[model samples]
Each structure stands twice: as structure tokens, then as C-alpha cells.
Target: MESVSRDLDMPDDSNPLRRLSLEQLRRRTSMKWRTYPHDVLPLWVAEMDVPLAEPVAEAITDAVALGDTGYPAGTAYAEALAEFAHKWWGWGGLAVGRTAIVPDVMLGIVEMLKLVSSPGDPVIVNCPVYPPFYQFVGNLDRPVVEAPLGPDLRIEFAALENAFRSAGRGSARGAALGAARGANRPVYLLCSPHNPTGTVHTAAELTRIAHLAREYGVRVVVDEIHAPIVAAGASFVPFLSVPGAENGLSLMSASKAWNLAGLKAALAIAGPEAADDLARIPEEVSHGPSHVGVIAHTAALRDGGDWLDALLRGLDDNRRLLASLLAEHLPSIGYAPAQGTFLAWLDCRDLGLGSDPAEAFLKRGRVALSSGRAFGTGGEGFVRLNLAASPEVITEAVRRMASAVV
Candidate 1:
């Protein structure tokens, strides 16, 4: 691998994404780097091209040095998250007693779905979302119903209500029992600071969703892994903090914000009213979290705040940089600045790349972007680019994409 030094456009030294050179990043054997050929500028997957936070690295190293590898134990993860949440989002209601440790965000979401809905029940998701929402829910034998987001990439309340009604038809038992029971109800899997599009759902939107869920006897399960990655103007509202959300469940992890996805640990938090439902989770599910993962995640939530802030700033810069690069190099492509998450959803319909623009980018430009079709409805003729990279790489990716178009 050839060494590539920092570009003048890179963020300041405090930005973790700028810490590693291209060669150093290529040395990583993670899915992000290894999935593509040597020449391909991979901007797919959720992995961040950044070094681990010092606190996270230290915690993991110390644990390994002490040979402290064992099954996860204690409420440390939940407690750390509570502190982080309170400090960052002004959420003071994270009851550690109502939380459970799960392997990761997606698995935690799957388990949460199982807790509220039975096999063959409908699981509703906003389309053009994380593809796993469909895969995991389908693997559990639950059918996935799509409620596509509105043109603004925000949740569509009417579409959501329609999905809720459609899903409720199959759960007559739950609807008949009313919202209080919440048994045999359809599960609405929400991606906060939504993936692909990076739309930060406002508190008002979340509260309305909670109200609708209550009215339709739909259970809301939120994937809040990107909770800590919101940009400056956007506020991340924990689904559980909103009114009428006492029956909702949320899965949070420090993985996305801290770039600790390889270390699998997440928290499944229940609303006060849903504690009984959470308690029904299989005990074996708790065994899924790695002890080291717990330690790393705890350290991240507790001690990695400054690093997270720096990363967010870097991401903000990268998102803006991408906008300029696209405007200059790929002028026909449409991209809205993301409110959160390090992903950019690009509209490639005008590029005439047909349904899957990622294929053309990969083959012609040697740039790997996430296929929009895999994200389901409203995703075709689009591509999801991972913006958690050096400014130079992002620039080069856009140049390559433009070349492919030409």
C-alpha cells in the first residue's frame, strides 16, 4: 500500500478521521477496507475511517492486559449511557433498571421486536432505511411493511398510519386488547437520525409518532445507534423521552459515535410501562455481549465525549465538502446535507445510471458506494455514500463518480 499523507483539506488534528493516512487505513482488515479492491475508494458501509478514541483504546488494552475477558456483567454500560444521554441530550430519564444488554444495535432491535410482536406479525419500517431492518425482521419470520418517507426524507405520518392499520389487521388480538396491553402488536422500527438519508427526526415528530403508535396499538422500537452523531443544528430526541412513548423500546450503542462497531455491545432500553415486556426477553440474549465490548462502550460513553465532539465537527466539514465537490464534479447529482450520521444519500436519477447507480460507480469509477436498491422503496436511482473519511478521499470519490458518468 502506498502512503498517503494528510491533505490540506483534511480537518484539524483533533478530528479522528484525519488521524490516519490512506495507507494506515488500508492496513485495517475491517469490512470497509477489505471488501473492495486495492484501487477502489470504498465509501460504503457504516464503518468510520478513524482511529479508536483514546479512552476506548485504553480501556480495551487495560482489560486485555489484565486478562479480564469473560462474559459481560453489571449495569455499567447502561449507567454510562444514562450519564452521556443526560449530559448531551438533556435526557435524565434513562432508568438503568429498565435496560438490558444486547449484542449490538441490530440484534438488540430484533430481540426487542420479538419481545413485543410474535412470528408472522408485521414489522413496519421507513423505506430507504438500513437494509438489515428487512433482513433481520424477515429472518425472525415477521413480514416487513414499508412506510416510505416523504419527499423531504422525513417520516410521513399518513403513510405511517396506513402501515399501522395494515399491520394491525393481522394483530386483531392486540388491537382488540387496546393500546394498554400492547400484546401481539405490530412493531414500528424507527431509525433515528435515519440511515442513508441522515434525517434527524425532531422531538415533535417523535412525539407524534408515539401518539400514533398509541392510537393504533403499534409498538415503537427505535434504533438510536446514531443518537450521538447529530449535527449542530439538529437535536437527537430519544424516543423513550417523548410523551406517549412509555410503551416504546430503544436500542442504543456507542458503536457508531465511537467507531466501535467491531466491539459488539448495545443497550435495550424499555419505557417505564414496557418494563414487564422487556423482562420477557430470553436470558440467553444477555450472554451475547462481549465483556471487552462492554468495557469499551462504557469508556466511550463516559470518557469519549470530547472525541465525539471533534468527530462531529469533522463530519460536518466533510458533509459540506461533499456538497461542494458534488456541485463542481457531479453537478447533476442531487445531495442534501445530512443532519446526522456520516452517510450521504445521493440522488442519481438524473445521471441515467438506471436503478442501481452503485454498480456503475464501482465498475467504471472503482468507487464503491452503497446500492440504493438494497435500501428498498425510494432508494432506486440513488446511492448512499459514507462520508466518514478524509476530505481528500471524499473529493476523489466524487471525481471518480463524475468520471463514471462521463
Candidate 2:
């Protein structure tokens, strides 16, 4: 691992995705690298194929050198996020007072749900979203209601309105929670720059959502972990920055952009109207983040801008590269260049792979990808490919996938 790091210690302007060799990546034991046989090209999970940003690596190293491993404390993580948001997304409204540090984005979401809802109450989601949105919400005993995205992979207001109304309908669970919380409002768990498809919601779309949530008496909680991974010509609109969203909540982190997922830490931010509810999150939840995770996240938000820019450049190139490769070798597969996040959602129905093309790719092509079936409704006959690897590897993966069909 140390040798791999040394090989990847390139200038900030260089493409980090191309720094490490395939042999070096094989040395990794992370779920992404170790889940398949050595011959398979792994492009399934959210993990990035890059080394740590210099500032993030240094921060973690310095903390360990000083033996400063202790429980997380202070608001440095929130403050750093505020600065980053203000500079990058033009979001100057991130209130540190309204933020709480949680173990990770999913856990923070679970905690937030508890504040505005009860078990068995329906929690709405844009279908074919992150698989964990279903797993975690269901585990909490809260039923998930699908408001599947439109054919364009963008939110369909009519579908969302239908979900909100359906979730608001009287039920044993809804009546119970309504009586206690003063209203039987459902919670919409939105995935901005949505997973698999990578659709970045426009500000107008978000403002419309906020209006609908208000009209329908619904609560909105967003996972903005991919906020920083957006490509050029597109912008990320922070949910809390738009009008009518003063009651919405969002979870943000530097973990995704900086490849610091193993170091678990994320901030749950409340809108001005939702601060009291956010405060109700159990005090013990604050203790869940690692001191090291906080330090690394803060450093990444505060000083890793250059490294992140380099990564976005590499990912932009890779997205275009994947499009061309598919057009050349696997023209039957449907794909749109992702607007954000290093993931590609492929329409494989045309390939006759029957529901999950990823299975065929892994078995016949020795390439591992995420099965779209796992993403829920509207995900059938699709697959998700990770685009955060070297151009060479991405090209090879496309060749392998094409060969699978042949």
C-alpha cells in the first residue's frame, strides 16, 4: 500500500485515476478490489481508484504521529464544509449551528428520519436510487414508497406528488405518527446527482420539490455526498440553498470526493426551520465519528480543492472515453455521460441480458459491475459501471462487456 501511495504521489494537476498501475490496484484488499478473482476487472462499488489527497493524507498521518486518536469533538468539520460550500457551490447559507456530525451519510439519514417520522410510516424515495436507501430505511421498520425518476433520470414532479399523496394517506402507522408529531407527513429521501444515472437536479427542480413537500406536508432529507463530484458545464444546487427548503435537511461529506469512505464522518445539516428537530437527534450520535475521520474530512474540505479539481478532470475525460468506447464496441448498450459522480448507468435491455447484465459480464467477460436490479423499480435490464479508473482499464472493461454479448 505504501508503495502504491508513492507511485501515486503526483502533481495536483495530474490525473490521479491513472497514477496507480493495475498490478498496484490488485494489491488492494478493499471490497472493490477483493470481491472478485484477480482476472476480473472490478468497476462495481463506489470506492475510487486513487490515492488520498496530500492534505488529507498528511492530516491523518500527523494525527497518528502525535497519538491524537481520541473521540471526535468541536465543529471543525462543519466549519470546513461551510467554507467549501460557499466557495464551490455558491452556497453561503450552511449554518454550523444547524449541523451535527454523524458516523456517515446513511447513519445520519436514519437519525434524521427518526426525528420527523416513526417506524412503519412510509418514506418516499426516487426509485432506482442507491441500494442502501432501501436497505437502511427498511431496517428502521419504515416502509419505502417509490417515486421513480422519469425516463430522463430526472425527478418527475407528478410522480413525486403521487408518492407524497400516497405516503400521506391514512394508515395504522401514519395515524399513530401523525397524532404524535402533529401531522402525518411522509419523508422524501432524495439522492441529488442521483446514483447510477448521475442526474444533477437543477435549482428550479429542487425549489419545485420544496414547494411540493410544503404543500403535501412532507419532510425532505437529501444525501448530498456527491455534491462535489459534478463535472464542468453543470452545477450542484445545495438543497438548503433554494427557496421553500427552510425545513429540509441535507447530509454532506468530503468522504466521497476525497476517497475517505473508510474514515467514517459526515455532517447532517438542518434548515433554519428544522434545527430543533435536528437537535433532537440523540447526543450519543455525536460520539459515533472517529477523531481521525473528522481530521481527515476537515483537511480535505479545507485544503484538498486542487486535488479534487484534478480528479474531476480525470473523471470528465473518463466519462467521454466510456461513451466513445461503448459506441464503438457495444453500440447496443444505452448510456448517457454522467453529469456528476464517477458512475455510468447503462441500459442493457437491448443486449438481451435479461434483467441483470452485470451477471453476464462477470460470468462471461470476467468484469464485475453493479447489477441494476439492486437499485429497485425501473432498474431492470440495466447495469452500473464505475468510471473512476484509468482510461486503459475502462477501455478494457468495455471490450470485455462487448465480448460477453458476442
Instruction: Put down candidate 1 lDDT per residue, 190-291, tens digits, no spaces.
Output: 999899899998889999999888777788999999999987788888999999999899999999999888999999999999999999999999999999
Work out the TM-score per prediction: 0.96, 0.95
Residue 60 miss distance in model 1 (angstroms): 0.9
lDDT of 2 at 337: 96
**Alpha-carbon local distance difference test for all models:** 0.90, 0.90
Query: What RMSD does each model have against the real structure?
Result: 2.3, 3.5
Inter-residue clash pairs, candidate 1 = none
Query: Where is the poorest 10-residue window by lDDT in model 2?
Result: 1-10
- Writing each residue's lDDT as its tens digit, candidate 2 over 2-77 gives 3434444443338889877777788988999888888888999999989889999999999999999999999999
- Residue 116 in model 2: shift from native, Å? 0.7
